[model samples]
Target: MLAVAATWSRLAAMEFDHVIIGGGSAGCVLAARLSEDPHVSVCLIEAGGGGDDIFIRAPALIPAMISGRPRINNYAFLTTPQPGLNGRRGFQPRGRALGGSSAINAMLYVRGHPRDYDEWADLGAEGWSWADVRPWFLQLEGNGRGGDDWHGGGGPVQISDQSAPRRISRAFVEACAEAQIPRNDDFNGPEQAGAGLFQVKQFRQGQRKGERCSAAAAYLFPALGRANLTVLTRTRAERVLIEAGRAAGVLVRRNGRRRKIAARGEVILSGGAFNSPQMLLLSGIGPEDELAAHGIAPVHVLPGVGQNLQDHLNYTILHRSRRRDVVGLNPRGLVRLGRAAGKWRKTGEGLFATPYAEAGAFVHSRPGLDRPDLQLHFVIGIEDDHMRRLHLADGYSCHVCALRPQSRGSVGLVSRNPADPPRIDPAFLSHPEDLATLMRGARIMERVLGAQALAPWRGGRLYPHDGSDAALAADIRARADSIYHPVGTCRMGRDEMAVVDPQLRVRGLQGLRVVDASVMPRVIGGNTGAPAMMIGERAAAMIAGAGGDGGAKAIP
Candidate 1:
């Protein structure tokens, strides 16, 4: 053990041109793109094992990783008790491996409404307008449907149509259409307000077709053989080593030993919403009062380091399924799943390739809305409380979430300990407007589920409630939680409260940047995985262009 520790300590002394703190969605992209130059050395540090497990690759096995029992590749962190949720602490499951949440998410490839980015530009995030960021989205997408005005043909992340969607999923889309929501085959196309099956982040062709196309699979693994890139897994970054007010390196722990990994060019934090802001606070680069309270000497005073936390608060309307084809914990369902697993092993086309929330829609909760304020995810299983609470009967669920929530929460330090989980407070539905919008969305979903298209499969409504506004409001408060899209904790803007500039460089500090969903000024209207990757693509361009010496450098 001493010899092994000595070898690791010596390897840690080696400096790299760029050292990324989190090997997540954006970190994988950054490592791949930055190392493309071949002259610059890049090191990616991940706190979990390599994300190449069979459970991660198989889309249908998502529950195995997400379920916190065995805690496969999931961080499975829980948020502080939310007042809006009747003081119930919501479950916050983030991927702990190289691909990050993208490795364990439902695999939906949603790019959000264009106006989400336009709003960011309007809010002082310069160069982040819809027109400016669209190209980056296109550049990173490899859609199986081929490139058009809104998509790219060949890129790192593969996007494909669901290989074999369940019949119930199709019925859900039809029911949405029957309830007056128009059918939209392509949600990522010109309009996002409609119902249809979702395109997933999965391989569409080749031997790995139908497998989850996580960031590690699409970007990092392909670049692993590059001489300039080094990936260190199960390595925890303790704090950023700031020297003379410029970020110099990171103090990390591996195998219970501490070592400093020098960053000759820049240090990037892509630790998603929770960990990214935690990293800033741990380094004494956040609110002065918070840092002082934790007994950590202040390195930089950025009051907005962990503020403006936002997430999509979702409420579900569940119904027991009359048919046996849907996913459940019954004997018949398990037998079917066993057979499906066998088929998946032979050919990557079966129930095993399913991204459970197969079909969904985006619709306005009321008239006069410019864009879809509500998003619905039609799950083919009975997902009660992030699938932690299981039911014996087969059922289906429809999740209704307010896309642009007005509520804002925060992430804060517990004791300046990197090992300790940060206090996460998404404060879902804290705003009166958010609650009202979600209530309206729930009514809409109830109607869609009642439509004739789903009647054949829909059984008695689970947790049946009287059709009253007051009853619906109570249900929402009691059961609402996040759909796993957390963002904006380390928001980027030119305002005083901004942690990073529009170029993603941490304000009031040099040689440090944040390139993850946490830097979003506002959470988008859809899943955050694709947008997080886009941020990485845009940051790589900014770093390459700003580097006058042909190596990565902090932009002034």
Candidate 2:
């Protein structure tokens, strides 16, 4: 373990078998798995503090950590103004600590529909079909419900049902069922089109039960006792050093001093959707024209280095609740919260253990669709503008997002300096089809909230709309933004636009690969945290030449 504030006069030059940039969700998995052989050395570098604080471990403090005002453990990056969003800039809050976004997220453990991976294989991502990748997902999960054909038990990543979901959350699920959406106990099972409580990436048993089990807590921290692994926090990678057409090392800066760390084997970038592509462009491995425009000498000309950006654009519907059980800023709610905190500390179960977005549903926006095209999240409290805005009255919110959008965007350089944030443009709702689907979804959600199952709790709709297409379309354009699932900037495929190959290796480059959500051929139907870790697990096997098809064996 190392800190940036420590003196590094004696650590001028260091070498490792593998040098991984961005100590995030996937990077933690890579560092832990690759260093298990004992003979191999791994170095993991992160630009944030260690992710073991109470703000991250406690499940209910999500709003505090996700706030942009103080920027707790979040990057809180703002996207470029989207013409599709009435020219309003969207908020993109990414985690900046060891566990990455998983540490600050709502901890929903979603695997997406199986066909999502099948689509990846269809898009020239060979050896990544549903059947081929199922083992990897099973191998990474430690489900509290025990192992079944669809889930795994005793794995590194802990998953559990919400300890004590709020009453309004249950009411929302019931309302979904009343609206004709079937009740599903497990979204990762045979069927995905239904409503139920979402399983979270949290400890299910033992002393840490109900706590957030981020990738760093599940993998990296457990492997820290290994002598061959070195974890460096608050260290930023400026660029990758390419010598003789091969990735040789990374130049990093810590505490204002720059150092060169050589990689004897490989250099992996796991900086999520935005930073991974930005790193490639900074290393002069992107388009020739973009490089020249930035005053950078192009080393590799991969035109797709930062293209194909996709995300789930979400619009939330809120209602003031007549019931006091839902979370709120009112006096009665605050008193309940104080008592719940004490109970949580004593028993690891209470209101403080809530993940907030406790219940959700997957449903098709219209008739005749084979699978669900819209996903919904039920929040226990009123949330607007990513929770940046607060409400004093007791209320609840339901978030609806199109499962797969057709719009494409890109991540580009603002300057050659690595310190500058990437220029992000999700280009949300640019396609007419996306807007159509969201309109249908919004109508469906309104019906569900109006169902008799939620009549006891429903108070007043926060954002009311006249029943008309134009009103709904205008509301969508004004309020819709990202649900924080951004992917496909450094897309993986065999096409000319693919940034990385099927094996996750950078096209036309050696000893370098991208193993994060950025390499996703398309964004999945749900959250990106679990899929990102699965990518790391599969990539480790491929890099180590272990399983022939990159299938991970269950860890005993």
Q: Mark the regions of model 2 whose C-alpha exceeds 4 Å error after superposition.
A: 1-13, 548-556
Q: Each candidate's TM vs. the true structure? A: 0.97, 0.97
* lDDT scores of the candidates, listed in order: 0.89, 0.89
Backbone clashes for every candidate come to 0, 0
Query: What TM-score does prediction 2 earn?
Result: 0.97
lDDT by residue (128-244, candidate 1, tens digit) is 989999999999999999998999988889999998999999999899989999999999999999999999999877888778999989998888888788788888999999998
Q: Weakest 10 consecutive residues, lDDT, candidate 2?
A: 547-556
